[model samples]
Target: MKKNFILLFLSASIIFFGCREKIVTVEAEKNTNKGGLLFKIDKVNAPKNVVMVEAILSRTDFDTVKASLNLVTETSADLALNNIPIGAWQLNVNAYDSLQAIVYAGETVVNVQDGIITQVNLTLIPTSSGLGSIYIYVNWGKIPTTAWNDFELNPILPSPISSTPPLRCNQPKVLYDDGKFKMWFATFKYGFAPNTGYAESYDGFAWNVVKENLFDLQKNDSSSYSRWDANCVIPGAVIKENGIYKMYYVGFINSSGEWHIGLAESKDGISWERYPEPVLKANSTEYQISAGDIIKINGVYFLYYSFRYNTISTMPVQFTGGISLATSTDGKTWKRSETNPILTKSQGWEVSRIYYPSVIVENDRYDMMYMDGSGTGFGMASSKDGYTWTKTTTRPIFTLADTKGAKAYEVVYPFCRKINNKYFLYYSSASNSDMLTITIRVAVK
Candidate 1:
C-alpha cells in the first residue's frame, strides 16, 4: 500500500498530539504539593447562628480526597488550603445546624509540604443549650458606701473552708466575730517553719491550727520583751475601732539588717500585745520595706509594701524591686502614696516586679492582688482610685499550675475574700525557698 499508508499517517499524528499534551499535564499536577494548610475556628465568646462547615480529607487508606478550601469569618473561623499534598493527611471538621443537627465535630492531623501554612486552630465547646451561663456580677460597683446597699459583697463559702494539713496558707485575715470565723494565716511548715499561724473557721475551709505559735521564735522571752525572729511574724490582722484587734507584722530586724513593720494588739482573739518599736521602718537608705499589707479604706490607713532599691552599685549592695504605697491616719504615722509606685513592670506576667498588695472592696472596685514578680502566675489589678491601676489582659489570675510545690520559680500573694456569693483566694508559694508555702483558691458567683 502507498508506503503503508504513509506509515499509518505518522503513527496517528503521534497519538493525537500526545493526547493534546496531557491535557495541561493532568490539570497542573492537581495541586503540585508545595505545602499548604490553614484552618482556624475559635468560638469561646460564642453566640452566632449561621453554621455549616464541612472540610474533609483522608488517606492512609481511608481513601477520600477532595481538597480545595478557603473559608473565612473574621473574628474566628478561617480555613485555607491550597496546593496541599505532601504526605500524612486526615482532617474532618463538621459543624451543621439549621436543624440538620450535628453541631460540631473535629479531628486533626496534617503535614503538607514546604511553603508553610499548617496552622490548625480550632476551639468549639458549645452544646449546653448552645452554652451561655457565666455572668457573675457580685455587687460590681467599683466602692463608696455609707451603710450597706453598696451591694454588700463578701461571699465565699461554697465548699472549702477546710482541707487540713498545712496544705498551704497566706495572708488571710477574717474575724467577723460572735458568730465566729476568725482565720489568720502565714504558715509554710511544709517548706519548713514560717510562723504566725492561727486557724478556726466556723467556715472558711475547715481550719483549726489555733495558735500554732503565734509569733514564737522558740519563746524568746527576754523577760517577755517577746523575742520572735527565727525570721518572721507575717501576720496582718485587722479590726480596729473599739473592737480592737489590729495585727500587722513583717518583722526581721536582727540588729538592723532591717525589715520591720511589727505592731500587735488583740483583745479576745487570744492574748497579744507586742509593740516595742517598729511601726514600719526600713527608712530608705535607698528603699527596703518588705511584705506588709494593711487597708482601712475611706478612713485612710493603707500600707501595701515591698519596695527595694540599690542597683547603682559601687559594690556594696545591688537590688531593684518595686511595689510601694503608704498612708496612715493613725495606724501610726506613715504617709507615702502621692501616687508612689502604684504598680509597675508591664508585659506578660507582670514584666519583672510587682509585689504583695492585696486590697479588696469590690462592688465599688479596688481589687488588686499582686506578686507577678516577673510572671508565670498571680496577677490582677483594678482600682477606681486606690491610686490609678487597671492591668488585666486576662493576665495570670493564678498559675504555676495552681500550686503543688509551685515552680515557674514561684512567688505569689493574692489573698481575697467575699463570702456568701463566693470568691476566696489565699495564696503564696515559693521555690528557691526562703520557705514560702500557702494555698487556698475558690472562685464562684
Candidate 2:
C-alpha cells in the first residue's frame, strides 16, 4: 500500500510542474508583444526664449491627456516610455504661454515594443498675427540692393532744382512716366502756398523738386466760399488716369476748421490745374471726409480715404479713422463703394490712426503701406482685390534709428520700383521738428 501511494504522488507533481511552465511561457510572450515608446519635443528650430511645452495624447482607449512639460536648457523636451504595452498612441505638442504662444502643436503616432524604444520626432510652428497698420515687404530678388547708387553728402537732382523748406510730406503717390519716376506728395503747410508738391527722379535715387507750392490754398471765390485744404493736404497725389495725375488734397478753412478734399490734374508732371469745384466736400454738420491714396487695378479705380465726425457739433475732432474705398469708371465722378471704412486701426501702433495708404500692385497682389503712431513706424496690409484687404503681420518695414545725435521721426510714402531685377524703396523721412527729407534705400531679394 505505501509503495503505491509514493508512485501516485510523483506522477501528480510532474503534471503540476508542466502546467506552471506553460503559464510562464504565455506571460513571456505577452511581455515581448509590447515595446517601449519614446517621444521628444523638437526645439532646435524654435524661436528663442521658450518656457514649457504643452503636450496632448490621444488614443482609441483614451480621450485626450494634456500636460505642460518644462523645457530643458537645450530648449527641448525629452520623454521616455519604458516597457509600454503594444498599441497606437498619438501626441500633440504646443508652446507654453510664457513663450508668447510662439510654437504650434505638432501631432504624431507610434507603435511601441516591450523593450524597444520607438523614437518619434516633432516640429513646432511659429505663431503669427495679422499686420497692425502698415505693411512693407522688400522684393530684393527683382531689385537688387547693390544696384542702388549711394547719394553724395548733399546730392542734387540730375536736373537743376531748388530746395524748399521741409514741409510735412506725408502721403506719397509714385508712378513711372516718360522714362522718369514721379512722386506727388502732400504736407501740412497752411496758407496761400500750395500744400502739395511734385518730385522727380531719374534712377529713383536723387530727387529733383519739380513743383513746389503747386496748389493754391486760398479761399475760392464761390458760393461755398470754402478754402480747400486750408490746414493741410495730408496725402498729396493719386493717378486718376494713365496720363492724368489727379491729387486728392485735404483743405481746412479758418472759419469752421473743417477739413475737405480738393481735386487737381497734371499732365506734364509739374504744373497742376485744380478743379474750380471741390471734388469731395465735407459735411459741416456731420463728419468730414479726408481722402487718401487712389489706385487703379484692371481698369477699376479705387479711392481709399478716411472719414471723421459724422455726428453732431463737436470740437475739431478726428474720430477713429478708417480706410474707405470709392469706385470711379471715368476717373472723374466717384461714388462711395461702401459707406464704411474698409480698414481701420483695431490694435497695435496704428490703433489710434490708420491713415495715409500707399498701395502698389506686385505679382497680382496689392501691397499697401501705411503709418502707425502706436509704434512710430510703417506697417503693411495685403489685398487680393482692391476692396477687401487683409492686415498682414505688422512688421516695421522702416523705423527711426538714431544716427549721430539725429533721430528719424517717421517713414512716410514708401514707393517701390524695380530696376535691373532689383527693388528700390524711395521713402520720405523727417525729424521730430517736421522737417521733410526724402531718403532712398534699396532691398535685395
**Candidate 1 local lDDT, 1-445, one digit each (tens):** 0010100000000000001110111122544554544443333222244244555767753346443222223443444444445666666555555564555454555555454433333333233244211111222212222212210111121113233443455556665566445766665554344556665543333334556557655445464334434456667545656887888777763533566677788876556777877777776542556644676777887777776665666476555576777788888777777776877767655765777677777667777777666435667778886778777645675666544212324545656666544455555444334543334333222
Q: What are the lDDT figures for the candidates, one per model?
A: 0.51, 0.50
Worst 10 residues of 1 by lDDT: 8-17
Which numbered prediction scores highest in TM-score against the true structure?
2
RMSD of each: 25.5, 25.3
Q: Can you tell me which runs of candidate 1 are displaced by over 4 Å?
A: 1-174, 180-246, 250-259, 268-274, 277-287, 292-307, 312-319, 322-352, 357-415, 418-421, 424-445
User: Candidate 2 regions off by >4 Å?
Assistant: 1-170, 187-194, 218-235, 240-242, 283-286, 310-318, 401-406, 413-422, 432-445
Query: lDDT by residue for model 2 over 1-445, one digit each (tens)?
Result: 0010100000000000011110111122334464433334434323344566554556664445444545544333444433344566565555554635533344445544344434433322232332111011122112332333322111222123334443445445566776555766654443444366677654443355666656555545564444454545544446635677677766665434466667777787567776766566666432566665677776777777666553334566446466677787766677776545677776566667666666777788988767664436666789888878888866565555412112445555455545434445545555455454543232222
Tell me the lDDT of candidate 1: 0.51
